[model samples]
Target: AKIKRVKGPYGKVHRGFLKGLTLVWSEIREVIREWQIHGQSVWVTGHSLGGALATLAVAAFGEEAKPIHGLYTFGQPRVGGKTFARNFDLEYQARTFRFVNNNDVVTRVPPRNLGYRHVGTVLMFDHAGILQTDLHFWNHFLDRVVGRIEDLGKPGTDGIKDHNMA
Candidate 1:
């Protein structure tokens, strides 16, 4: 996907993700305002591609009259570059939880080398389905090794299998 600089505080993000958000933002904003009017906090969540859009939605809502209560995403890909990640983290790090299931491949792209990066705190589930917070790289590496070995007989790669929401 191509990167484009949005004309707001989010810095540069994935063009496709930005376009997806733009297509539905007005409706989403209206719903959020309706909820806020009733004194309800607005929490956003999505999985995979939707996750990426959810991230942009929260950032877009940051300057609105009502703030987003929280954001949660699953198997989300990198949405932007360093500036966007840093800015988003500064604002919503405590309010965002990004879940990665085992070796879910979606979370690792569009490749840091391409200047894309993920925002929010990561809460990962290892191969044994045990939840881990802020796991060290060595520990994460060993877990992936174990998962791949266990998945040797499986039809698909562990990364792809792990991406399943189920």
Candidate 2:
């Protein structure tokens, strides 16, 4: 695959992710070739930070690359800005599945306001559970990391708890 820095609205990304991919590209290609020699399919998966890396790896593989089967990511934060996201979505729409907990705080980081965007189909989970309605220092943690559900219609209560892996 052609190597170049992938620029995003917020900043350049090929330095961080793509550079890493390039460093190992030869080895990865060799591995894939070896796998293909045995008629094996390649499927990538990761969670949290690993998911972000997997997303980049798949992109580096190129859209039409053979032997790569699909990607499945969990609680992956935004990896790049709109352009990268758009390209990734377009290229891998049929194969990428991004699973995000409804309120996973990590998924909301490097916010869109900062020009970061998410790619792939977001498989959101809105699991029902008791919520801690009262505000607390752990509100974001509880709502997102703990996956609790407050009463939806209650005054001052919002269904903000939905971020847990559970």
Candidate 3:
């Protein structure tokens, strides 16, 4: 993957993702073109790191992303700064759906202090299994592969346990 910094309104972005998208874009475009010819709609979804890639991909696609049936991402880290977020929101017009487990800690990263801001409508999953905006910064490290399941699976688990996307 090529790693060149692409300039966004607020800062630079991961070039590897952009390069990957460029490499695959022709195929994706062909598929979408065929689907559109058949009156079908396009959709995109991703989780964690993939979510960031999906967001970047959609943004890079620009107008091509507008016709997508939906865009959903889970446990995504902040992708860019305020300017990038603003531009993405304007271009996609709420088409992106950022799903955050309110307890998940990963969502808070690249920190706002670093100028990273999220784009699209944030659909937060509160501790109650209901959607809400109540988020805690300590919930991002619930990865099963990292042995967090033991603590997370306990009865009445709160705090970090709630961060598990699994």
Candidate 4:
């Protein structure tokens, strides 16, 4: 089937806004129907385009349907417009997680004007990027108390440099 683009905060569909999400939802259903022949399960996650499709696929699965195993995405831009940005996942019950790096700018594609913020704690990979603020001091103090100085994603072998990309 043919596809048209959605309108994003920028020119249009820069991040696959929900302008035409219903079509994608239908396509996902087709995959599920076809996959049922094997009696297998489906898990969804993505960094960019895959993330957009995952979001729409799970949402289209309906409220009572079994929630997908997990929803993980990195450097994923805003999926919908100004309104969906606020409450799109209100009723959805999936384990949603986003891994964002300080310098990885793909997460803010189109750079719209708004106040949406990542809910998870920032796993600071580079301390140099942070300002010398009171909050930083507090976090360091807490780290000392807990005896865990490095974030889970900050280890030298954590591949932050490789995977912290767009």
Q: Could you tell me every candidate's TM-score relative to the true structure?
A: 0.93, 0.66, 0.69, 0.50
Candidate 4's displacement at residue 43, Å, is 2.0
Candidate 1 C-alpha error for residue 22, in Å: 0.8
Q: Model-by-model lDDT, in order?
A: 0.88, 0.65, 0.66, 0.48
Residue-pair clashes per candidate: 0, 2, 5, 0
Prediction 1 TM-score vs. true: 0.93
Worst 10-residue stretch by lDDT in candidate 3?
Answer: 139-148
lDDT of 4: 0.48
The best-first sequence of candidates by lDDT reads 1, 3, 2, 4
Model 1 misplaced stretches (Cα beyond 4 Å)? 1-9
Please state the error at residue 160 of candidate 3 in Å.
Answer: 7.1
Instruction: Report residue 140 deviation for candidate 2 (angstroms).
Output: 15
lDDT of 1 by residue, 19-101 (tens): 88889989988988899889998899999999999999998887563688899999999998888898889889999999999
Residues 1-166 of candidate 3 have per-residue lDDT tens digits of 2233567433465455456566777787787778878998778888877887788767766744436666799988777767778887886746788887645667777677766678888777654456754344444233222333444556754434545665
Off by over 4 Å in 4: 1-16, 19-25, 34-40, 63-66, 112-166
lDDT of 2 by residue, 29-86 (tens): 7887788789998898988777777788787676436546789988877778777877
Candidate closest to the true structure, highest lDDT: 1
Between candidates 3 and 4, which one is better according to TM-score? 3
